[model samples]
Every structure is written in C-alpha cells, then in structure tokens.
Target: MKRREAIKNLMLFTGGTILFSAGLLAGCNSPAGRTFISKQDIYFLDEIGETIIPTTARCGGAKAAKIGLYMKMMVNKCITNEERLIFLEGLKKIEDAAIEKYRVEFLSMNSDQKKELFLNIQLEAEKYKKDNKSKPSAPVHYFQLLKDLIVKGYFTSEIGATEARRYEAIPTRYIGCINYKKGDRVWATS
Candidate 1:
C-alpha cells in the first residue's frame, strides 16, 4: 500500500475507535442505562442510605459503596414506572414523617434517634401490611422498602462484598457446607 493511503486509513481507524468508545461511555453513564432517579432524589437517597449503613473504620459504608447510585440505577432500569414513582414518593413521605414526628430530618438525627424513629415506622408498615395482605403492594410501605433497598444496595456494592462481607473476587472454587462450632462469626454470602 502507498504510505499516504496507509496514513489516511490509520487516521480513519483511530477516529472510528474514538467515536465508538465515546458512544459506549455515554450509554454507560446515561440515566436510561440506570435507574431513572433524579439528582434531587439521589441527594436524599444518599443521606438515607448512609444512615442505614454507616461507614466504619474497617468497612466502607453505603455512601462509599454508592448505594444511592445503585438504588437509582435499579429503580430506573429494573423497576416498573409505577414502582419508581412510588419509591420516590415514599422517600419524601419518610422524610416528612420524620419531620412531623421528631421535628428533624431523618439524616440529622443521632444514631439512637434514627433507630427509634425507624422502629416506629417499621411497626406502622407492618400494621399496614397485615391490614392490606396483598402481594406486589405499593412500594410506599415505607419501612419495608427502605429496609429492602438498604440491604440490597449495601450487599451488592464492592465494599460490601470485600470489606463488609469479606468476599474474595478471584478463585471461584468453593467448598460446600463446612462444619462450624457454635459462637463463630457466620459466613457472609447471599
């Protein structure tokens, strides 16, 4: 091939590659690629998720795990539109309930206060569940949704897998059902 022709072909290939990569990155970062959560909602979610799973010295918390981002992505990409709306509205209601009950934001409360508030919410949610007794209930069952999201988001994060649960990524081989004596820390696996 002529040197000039080769140079032109190389430039074309480089340009195409750059464009392809840019497209891929855009798709990966798009809201459509994740949960369709708004930025304002994410701010509240971050605060709430951080409270549910606080960052510790040994293990990264929900914020470090980007649980809010994960929740948003899951809601947007996986959940139904109705569910997404309900969950979003549920979060707002939770905040409002906190303000009405304790005169403070849920995130602003101390650990004990947060726990107490959540306990009451949980009781109320349970009562609602018992009264309703229906499957695929509104995601606004408040405490149930919060608990589910917290557990789901935290455990799915890399920090949760590695530090919180002490999971190893490589070496996929596993031994089934090891014997353990009483009073040992339980293994962390789904």
Candidate 2:
C-alpha cells in the first residue's frame, strides 16, 4: 500500500508511466462492493482532461488521445477504493464549483471559463498542500490527480507519441549534442 501510495504521489507530481495500473490488468477482480466511474462521469472527465491539456499550435491534446477513457480504466482497475471515491467526488466537486462560479454546470462552461475553473482548482490544491505540510501522507486534491493523469495519458497515447513527442522505432546513430531548437518536441525514448 505504501508503494502504491508513493507511486500515486509520484504520478501526481511528475506524471509517471501510462495507465498500466495493477488493477487495470487485474480485470474485474476488485474486492466486492467497489464502485466504478460511471459513463456520465467520463464526459466531464474528458472536458477536464482537455482543459488540462488543450490543443495548441503544436498539436491536439488529451481529448485527441481519448484520455478520459484511459482514466476510467485506471480508476476502475488500478485505483484503490478510497482513491476511486475521491476521484468521483472530485468530479462532483468540479460540477459544484462550476455552478458556484458560473451558475452553470462544468460541462456548460466555455473554453475560457473551463480554463479559469481549472486554475482555481489548482490554486485550491496548492493551498491544501500548504495547510497540510506536516502530514507526509497527505492526499492530493482531485484536480491534481486529473492533471497527472492527463499528462501521463497524453504523452503515452498514440497521438502523443507520434505527434506531441518524437518517436522513432529505429534510430540512426546517436548524434551527440545538436543545436537545440526552442520549439522542438522531446524525444520519446520509451
């Protein structure tokens, strides 16, 4: 459990490997009474994920990679029951926050509104971390989780691999330091 917790925190901060959670591979073998992410949640999650990694001049973002579907698999399979609930509650929190801010649901928000909402959640998470600085095992806010998963899922997805980052199956000889370009995509060695 400590290892899993550590991995979760690590991903939350640094965005670890793709959605290969043990639960994902474990199939429907989670302990009985476990609640899974519902279909309705996926739509909001996609919106959030897209907000986290919006398409830009470079390439399409998490939505192009279908990150919400990947997140669903990760949460249902790999995430612990506790974290799973946190994730779902996080969705509800997003909706509630949206309503409070715009008098509309999160899904009803325009792109700019969504971005602003995400920024507010990020601020809240930072405040949460500061207030719980002494607690080593303090859990992160769900927005943090959403951001982490967006990065992981995006970078590992097909579009992320071939477009967002440079991916070559077979490489020529390693050319040691070429002149670096400012807008160059990072190499996907994995």
Candidate 3:
C-alpha cells in the first residue's frame, strides 16, 4: 500500500537524521586542536610556580603542593577551548622569552633569572593592556592565571594548611580579640 510505504520511509528518514545529529554533537564536545600537556610541561608549570613562591626558611613553595598538576587539571576541566589556546600560547611565550633572554628554559633558570623573566612578562602584559584599544572579557596573561592557581592550590594543600598556617581542626572557643604582630602567620582556619 502507498500509505504503508510512506510511513516506513518517514521512520527511516527520522532515524537517520537523529543518528547524524547525534554524531555531530558528539564530535563537537571536544575542542578542535586541544593541546594535551605532558609530564615535562607539568614540570615547567611546577617550576614557574616555584619561581613565583620559592622555598623559604619557614615554609615550602608551590612545588610542595604540586601546583603544576593542579594547574593542568584546572585548565583541562574548567576552561573553555579558547581559553585553553590562550593558556598554551602564554605558556609558550614564557618559555620563548626565557630562552631568548636567559639562554635557558624557564624551569632551568635560577630563581633570580626566573623572577626577571616573570617581571618582563608582567611588563609586557601591562604594555599590551595600555596599547590595546578594546577591553576584552577574557584573560590577557597566563602568568596571572598561573599565579592564581598556584595560590589556590597551595592554600588548599596539606602543606599550606598545616605548615604555612595554623590549622584548628576543633575550635574550643572563638577569640574575638587577638594581638597582632608585624609579622605573623595568620590563622588559616579563621
């Protein structure tokens, strides 16, 4: 019957359309050319964080908290595709700058040299902000993101919670007034 043929054709067309659409959607979930950072890059991130907050006599730096892994995880999970590209670019820029100026990779540079390189990048970012006409809503520098992640990862880490600041697991009483010193480790639990 003509009616039966039309119904069968309609069902087949609908099923094909659904399958095609589903396949397209699945392909779109992954960003095009999304960079996959390796262990070496992770080490670079750790060294970068370490340069920013090097190990002092009292406490350990970002490397102690494994800030590089934190940064990589956050980048892969939290940021958009565009942001990921920007991050990768900024990372390469840092490495390029370091190699050009210090004759070494950022991770291989000494703390002082690393500091100078970061300062240079900061200056360049400032110059970019001043020169650019439009104020875009996305991140302009990777160093800022790196620093933020380092701080967040470090503070939330066991070393930061236990060594850097006093961790009060159980609070018997809340001190309303406390004497302040010129230099003191603030209560992290507070």
RMSD versus native structure for model 1: 7.8
> Which is the better candidate, 1 or 3, if ranked by lDDT?
3
Which of 1 and 2 is the better model by lDDT? Answer: 2
Instruction: Provide TM-scores for the models.
Output: 0.68, 0.77, 0.74
For residues 91-175, write the lDDT of model 2, one tens digit per residue: 7788899999999988889999998888888999999988989998987678778788778888889888888988987897898
Best of the candidates, lDDT:
2
Off by over 4 Å in 1: 1-36, 134-140, 181-190
lDDT values for all models: 0.74, 0.81, 0.78
Model 1, residue 53: displacement in angstroms? 1.9
Query: What pairs collide in candidate 3?
Result: none
* Each model's total of backbone clashes: 4, 0, 0
- Model 1, 7-59: lDDT tens digits are 99999999999999876875565344432477667767777777778888788
Every candidate's CA RMSD: 7.8, 12.5, 7.2
Pick the winner on TM-score between candidates 2 and 3. 2
TM-score of 1: 0.68
Q: What is residue 77's positional error in candidate 1, in angstroms?
A: 2.3
lDDT of 3 by residue, 105-130 (tens): 77778888988888888787777767
